[model samples]
Target: MFETMALMPQNFSLPDAIWRLLISTGLLLLAIVILRTLTARFIRRHVTSSELRGRLLMNFRNGFLLLGLLGLALIWGDQIRSLALSIVAIAVAFVVATKELILCVSGAILKSGAGSFNLGDRIQVKDFRGDVIDQTLLATTVLEVGPGKTSHQRTGRMIVIPNALFLSEPVINESFTDHWDFHVFTVPFKREDDWHTAQKALLAAANRHCKPYLESVRTYMTKVGVSRGLEVPSVDPRVTIQVPVASEIHLTVRLPAKPRQRSYIEQAILSEVFADTDYSTEKP
Candidate 1:
């Protein structure tokens, strides 16, 4: 205990700042009281009307109060400035310490406010594509959808992505519609192997596979277009031709299919088309 006492300051007293503040406060209060008393006395003596005297006294007291505030502010200006700087530094430190947490909360707010995705919606943020299983302020739990976008089936993996990712990455909601939506798949063929016949075969496969939900998809697309005031694309089983290279032709097929059955529908269409058409060209 003696050693601890020895370690303490030998001649401890209040710092100069505290002493200065106390002295200044006492002096200001005293000055205000004395000035107010003198003003009241002078007003009462000079003013004949009681109302004028009261008004003058009140005005004088108010002036003194204002002056007292101004004087105190001037006296403690340095300390107040130091305190403001300290507060700002502490705020900056706090923000830096919780940067990621702040971002996550902000992302959650953005997602909710903008209606980015629902709990069951299939969403892709950056490379992470899955159905949202759960969501919270800091993270989102997803049932992993696929190894790639082509596969709609889950891979039996759960991904916990930080909500902060939503702020930085673009979110792709693949299953915006309730059930059936238009899905796109590509079927590639050699340019020399009867491209016309291959295109016809791919269209036939798409039409055949997608016939059940075609009308429903079209209706939904029309409803969505009317609600959003925008022109939605055709939901018909249409085929678009793309030639990325001189030797190859790609038949891009768009058709109606459920989100969960995208891969199966695509596979079935491609299987039927491939079995029906042969695109083998022997290079000389």
Candidate 2:
């Protein structure tokens, strides 16, 4: 007991040090539970704005929890500081062991400050493209989709992207405006499938989603241009049905991208097309 106590994390008894470590961990967890309870009950109930609530929750809940753990580690493993040089050496070794984690976290921190695009923004990093689902200090997640501007199907796969990608790769954000357009087409080979009719219908559908965005974007652009000296495009929302490949008719829709819900617009167009053709349909 004497020797063991002398060799404890803080040069205290191993048993006692472990007990305190466990206690500290437990308290930290308890603090989180209580913080969440209060945030949901008091903060959320009183603060209704989602953005404000999120900021507050992140500040108090996450910040305090981390602080509590740090404090406890200091207490329970207080003696570790005696070996500060050793600790640095071990940390360097661990960094080598988890190099990817270090790089990812560093990249994430850099991107986090840039406001990391937004939740509804569409960003492409490396070869992957999708809507931004979530962001953290280590990675960005995206809901996978087909290539090009149009998404034909939901990949149903959640992609965790390393934040480091943002530094070196190009990121594109679509739907910066309220107006967005989408298109879908019926296969040409389907029986009695009127490709022309499908094209017309798809165009009409694209226009429905496009007109509002176009008008709003135009209005917004005129206002911004006068004040901020920005140039806006004169293109109207449009859809074109073309046979991209021999097997499939590609209905390409051009419209201002909506802030987030590009996938919804695509699915809605596909759903409408299915009502007429029902060829190779998938749920949105």
Candidate 3:
């Protein structure tokens, strides 16, 4: 009779403790649910902007859930330390296993915030030059430009580069602020050819071809020079003579062009130079 009476207290206490834990957990969960619902409704009704509403809801939901979890942990305080240690171990293992994935995601975040490049911008990374078509946390998709072709024409190929490359490789954003690039071509002629006439002809051709963009190019270059500390060169077409070989004279023409139109402009200037009879005639 004594033994039975002594054991009854322990048995009753165990059940009482369990019941208290269950009740507390249920109340906490209920409170969390009510809080979530109320906050979500408040956000939806009061927040006008979709972006702001989404941000508020997400923050409130996470905060409320964290508080609920903390309350549950307090109720089961004895197991909290072990649970935390287990979570830390699992997190460390996951990070170690997915280090590359983490780096790629980090790179994506950096890219978005840094404004290194954007969709529809032409960028060159290492040997790959293309227009950005798609971007994700893991990779950036580009419509491939010239590889074997001489021009910056699309090659009809798509390339998916891991976002992690942005962290390690140099990225050249051709369309960063100014979409213009310099296009230069060298025309070879006989040593006895009239160099001055050739230079005049090349300059005229370039000016005629690039006249429409002269004002815009000048404004863009001025802004770039002020911001980036780069020397603002004249937007006017320039010709330089090079005599790399004794037997031939080379006339080089430099003009401002969009990256995609470099080849086209070069071809146009060459056609004009060939058509100029005065420049084409050899001096005896």
Task: Find the candidate with the highest TM-score and give its number.
Answer: 1
Q: Give candidate 3's root-mean-square deviation (CA, Å).
A: 14.1
Global Cα lDDT for candidate 2: 0.67
| TM-score (C-alpha, index-matched) for candidate 2 | 0.46
Model 3 weakest lDDT span, ten residues long? 275-284
Pairs that collide in candidate 3 are: none
Candidate 2 has its poorest 10 consecutive residues by lDDT at 181-190
How would you encode candidate 3's per-residue C-alpha lDDT over 20-107 as one tens digit per residue? 8889899999989998999899889998999998889889988998999889989888667878899999999999999999999988
How well does each candidate superpose onto the true structure, as a TM-score? 0.83, 0.46, 0.56
- Model 1 lDDT on a 0 to 1 scale: 0.87
- Model 3 / residue 56 / CA error / Å: 40
lDDT of each: 0.87, 0.67, 0.85
Candidate 2 lDDT at 253 equals: 61
Clashing pairs in 2: 175-257, 179-213
Per-residue CA lDDT of candidate 2, range 119-197, in tens? Answer: 7566677678877789887889888866554454557888889887777777766534434322233334333345566
User: What ordering of candidates by TM-score runs from best to worst?
Assistant: 1, 3, 2
User: What number of clashing residue pairs does each candidate have, in the order they appear?
Assistant: 0, 2, 0
